[model samples]
Target chain A: MRVLIVDDDPELAELVSRSLAREGHAVATAADLESARAALVEAFDVVILDLGLPDGSGLELCRELRAAGASVPILLLTAQSAVGERVAGLNAGADDYVVKPFALAELRARVRALGRRRESAPSVTYRTGDLEIDLSARRARRLGLEVELTPREWVVLECLAGSRGRVVSRDRLLEEGWGESSEAASASLEVLVGRIRRKLGRDAIRTVRGQGYAID
Target chain B: MPSTEPGRPSSGGRSLVRRVGLVAALTAAGASLATLSVAMVVVDYRVTSDAEDDALERARALAAELDAEARAQQAVTQAQLEDELREFSHGDVTLAVWEASGRLAGDPALPSPAQDGCEASAGPDGAWMVCRASSASAGRWVLVGEPRSQLLAHREPLLLGGLVALIVVVLGGIFAGISVGRWSLRPLVRLQGALTAMDAAAPQPAPSLPRSGMVEIDDVAATIDDLLGRLRVELERSRHFAADAAHELRTPLTKLRTELELRAEEHDEGSHEGRQLLRSVARVEDLGELVDHLLVLASPESALRGASLVSVSALVEAVVEDLDADASRVRLELEDDGAVVGDATVLSAAISNGLGNALKYSKGPVRVGVQDTAEHVVLRIDDEGPGLGEEARARAFEPFYRAPEQRGTGGHGIGLALIAHVVAAHRGDAAFVDDGPGAHLVVRLPRHRGVRPEQT
Candidate 1:
């Protein structure tokens, strides 16, 4: 798998590349903004970016890439682990952010997570038993037959499916389904999850108790 | 201008109260004195002229009489003139005559006077005003005089009255000055009160100045408020920088520990090198925890995003579940479902610190409970630790203040302090109750559960 690592810190970049290479990824490293932008021209499955760079910020690069219609998954590396900074990165089109000096194992795990998501980028779909949900087309089918799922139910199903095995938090699901500024009740999210379960069969989604839900 | 530096507000010139009072008093007193002096000059001129005209009239009348007397007799004697003048002059008027040769015939005590008009002189009898006239046909000169004190007697009484007037005028000027000063400076007084009433001890100093209704003063206040806002931003940035730096440090430490664990896992669990690596990872974990607390403490209120609300009982239970290693030592009892409006990351950090602290210090089972009320909600963690000492109770919330007994122990002294900082930012309270057998740490949060429904 092709992976691009963007970081101004040569040592950190080299270390991450070496670690990911051990996991059998063809890792390419860029030390600054100009090099990273140049590297983005080549088709890469995932881009691991450091927020701070010598020439410019990674957030600026993420924004530019998204504006240029680059749909590759971008993961941000931030030295400041403040939630505000994380939200800013996300708003700028970064899929995820990890604090700097992070564990190679965790970084690899996140990159693998991104790779798993990227593998299904064109038509990301989820399946369990006879139930299959199409995320790109916002469709759901059971045993090759299209089943009508309400718009809200589809959103809940999509969010849970998108979380990939990780727990999709109640707040995140609410925000994604009801828009970011939505003050929708947590109970509403649960009800939507319950409705999705009823339509897609009972074992389709797993309730992770206080956190949120996950795909069965 | 980039107002990142510590700025002092420029004053709007002198104190309004002082300036107004001084100007009012000076204007009132000066106006009174000016009017009094102008009146004095006018009255003095009139009185002096009238007195001179009366003396001249008296002298001219006497001269006519003497002239007639001389014309009647054709040979009037000085003794006759003197006797006739003495009868006419009663209290202060005296008459004198010179029969063309300039010889005085009246009171000799009077100084040599003008022979054609009136003159005031300091005579031997007293101050005297005399008038002289001549009748050439009769070949006789006649003079009439009176004491000058009559015209000026009123001056002494007027001086006393002027003194009384001056006292009254000064008193009235002070009263006017004070009233004017108070009236104009009322806005400034309100501004001062607003400044003083500000909470200086807030975790984040908010120096918000109220509008004073005066243009210049309000402008000054606005400028000051702007500077204060910039200063707060600068301070918040620096504080967050420290937190960020510590967090950055933690990431590397966490990575190092993870690498150590992976390497150690590949080796024998009883191997010497594996044990050493495990010990090193434990040390890294401790450092990571310290950095996490610092990050929590350094975090400001601006980090709160959206209308994020989390369940108090659920969050406590989740934390307890995550710290599963101490499952046997900790007990959880949730009474009610309570919610709080806050940032999730910060709340978790604070709760983790408190729970970790109880587990570390307690030898017996730790009791965790949630008590939710309508107005407020509390999470109490009771540890079977060496409860708080007198000194610990007082300085528990102080940062980095470690007890001598627990100095070399696992827990950092900043845990409670970090919790306090978070609670203050959330507008809540963190307190320790030592009445129980162990340390009772209570975190009180404002219970705000807003359950907005999504339309069907």
Candidate 2:
């Protein structure tokens, strides 16, 4: 899969690039509107955009891409998490919106989701140890027995399963699922994980303390 | 200190009720004194005239008796006439008998008598005469008279005493009027003091004027108290609205910032589009901070609620120490132990904002000082930046006002406005002073006598 990232902050752009590149996707970057426009004309699985730019806005580019009948998923990046901005960004044809000072892993997960949606892959199944996740069925099974999970718990389980043996940081989980600060996400994540662990057994997931959590 | 502009009218100058009452009291007293003095003079004149008429009638009766004796060829001795005259003299009147030649005839002690209308026609003396006379019988005339000056002399002391009494009464009345007026108006004076404090942005408890028997003054006091209550309510309403509006704006701003970060993740390092997105996010963050400052500036009620006894020096020192990492170039000086009773949150916010503003504008270094003065607790922040012009300094405390040069700065222009509001809530004032190349902002709060010492 190929993903294009457009942002003006060098540090943030580098962080997003490394995280997405680690996910086995080919990554490309554009710092401004002109370069982003040129990249949109080429083949790409997804485009990540920042709303404010030196020349033109990311929302305007999102609208133009949609008007040009480009169906590739475009995610918007903004500093303000205002509800109006989120509505405006999505209304301009963006598939998702993200706020800054975000964790890299969350950005990677969003890109994968966008990619999967773009590819239109149906009946996708994911397996980690005894846990099995079926995208089409929207259900989870462990040891070949069906498992009941709330919508939020299912999202958390999927995130952990998607990472497999790797650790998923608390910040990434918050940014990807809750769309809020890590402080709030960290607290909420504890409750969600507790529910999931109760249903799946505690030994299935491992806590990394300050770093993150991993599932085997 | 900058001189305030002349010609701006003062709201409370002289009150009308006080002036009118004073004038009315003085006039009534003066009129009463004048009427009493005139009455005393008339009474004295009438009494003297009546006494003189009684003595004149007795003298005429005596002379008729002597004339009847002469007609019978019976001589009357001068001794007997003298004894009759002596009886009339008992009440301080002296009488004498005179012949037709204007010579003293009966009494040797009498002076040579002057000829007058009483001698001319054997009738009563003319209205101007000192004596009254009438004929008895036998072509012999009888005269009885006393000097009018003696009667007038007695009347002189009484009249003088009455005039002196009148003056003493009038003086006593004026003294009484002033004492009564002041005693009666004491509650009004207290009410005026409370109102003045309220106008200066001090929190005053509701006025409780003692009920003066005077109906009109009591009404005026009550009306003033009602007006103060209404003004306080209006101010509270405006403050609440500003706080609510700010709270409402925060939720959306937070959500927008979260979404932007999520979108930025798809781009690669060194990408042209990635950098532009990052810059956009920073701008939104600045806007959110500005909004928060505006909310604090607009809501004075929040500051008023948290009033307490706090050490001004301690608050300044703590805030400066906490901000030291961010303000390496700034220096803080504690000049005196600044202690005052005020809202802790309000005082801290005001002091910190002053320090923040100093840090933002200064090029070299900023200095903060806390001092306790005789009348006020003072907090001063001096900066090494380009100082404000005279016009900007004058209008610095107004909400949403920025100096012309500072308009381009990325602030909402409410930093000083917030400080001003907080100062006002604590019964204080904020002002600007020149500090060489920079400006010094000072806040002075009234000293609170009951301020507690620092805990540790």
Top of the candidates by lDDT: 1
lDDT of 2: 0.64
What's the lDDT of the predicted structure labeled candidate 1? 0.70
Query: What clash pairs does model 1 have?
Result: none
The window of 10 residues in a row where model 2 chain A has the poorest summed lDDT is A145-154
Among incorrect, acceptable, medium and high, the docking class of model 2 is incorrect
Residue range with the least summed lDDT across 10 consecutive positions in model 2 chain B = B120-129
Candidate 2: true contacts recovered, fraction: 0.00
Please state the error at residue B333 of candidate 2 in Å.
Answer: 4.4
Evaluate chain B of model 2: give its TM-score.
Answer: 0.64
Worst window of 10 by summed lDDT in candidate 1 chain B: B1-10
TM-score of the first chain of model 2: 0.57
Give me the candidate number with maximum DockQ: 1
Looking at model 1, residue B197 earns an lDDT score of 57
